[model samples]
Target: MNGIEHYRRAEELMEQATATRTNKSGFEVCYVTNEEQERLTRLANVHALLALSAAQADATEFKRELYRANGEELPAAQSAKERAEAKTARNAALAAAFID
Candidate 1:
């Protein structure tokens, strides 16, 4: 599956983890156990990471294509420091997005 597909799967898993369902008597109940919910959430996080990685790779390829099309030299690989900084920023943004 592609990045978007992984992302959609992750969303579905999260929804399943959090959604309430009606019991036999028609009262709303959380069907999932705490452990089950935690497991699902962890799986969803894995998928989200995969999606993010795929998106970054696609963006890099797109930039390379654009440079080639414009007859410009491709950009150099990111230095280790730059990569570390980017990772930190990405993690921070993700944490902010998930903040309650």
Candidate 2:
């Protein structure tokens, strides 16, 4: 699936996790258990990350293509090790942002 598809799936999961229903008495109620909700939220986050990664890759590819079309020498790409470290740091920051 593409980035937009993954993003849409993530949004759908998030909605399911937090959705409220009107009970017969006309009060809003959540049917999902805490554990289930947490699981759904985690899944949503995974999809969101996948979408973000795909988007970044697409952007990089587009930039490379544009440079090529302009007869410009492409900039050196990051080494695999550098990319891994950057991804690790980015993930750490994202995790930290979710901490209480």
| Cα deviation of 47, candidate 1, in Å | 0.5
How would you encode candidate 1's per-residue C-alpha lDDT over 1-100 as one tens digit per residue?
8999999999999998998989899999988999999999999999999999999999999999999999999977999999999999999999999994
| Model 2 stretches astray by more than 4 angstroms | 77-100
Clashing pairs in 2: none
Please provide, for model 2 over 1-100, each residue's C-alpha lDDT reduced to its tens digit, 9 standing for 90 to 100: 9999999999999999999999999999998889989999999999999999999999999999999999998877899999999999999999999994
Q: How much RMSD separates candidate 1 from the native structure?
A: 12.6
Q: Which candidate has the top score in TM-score? A: 2
lDDT of 1 at 82: 100
TM-score of each: 0.69, 0.71
Question: How many backbone clashes does every candidate have?
Answer: 0, 0
Instruction: State how far residue 48 of model 1 sits from its true place (Å).
Output: 0.6
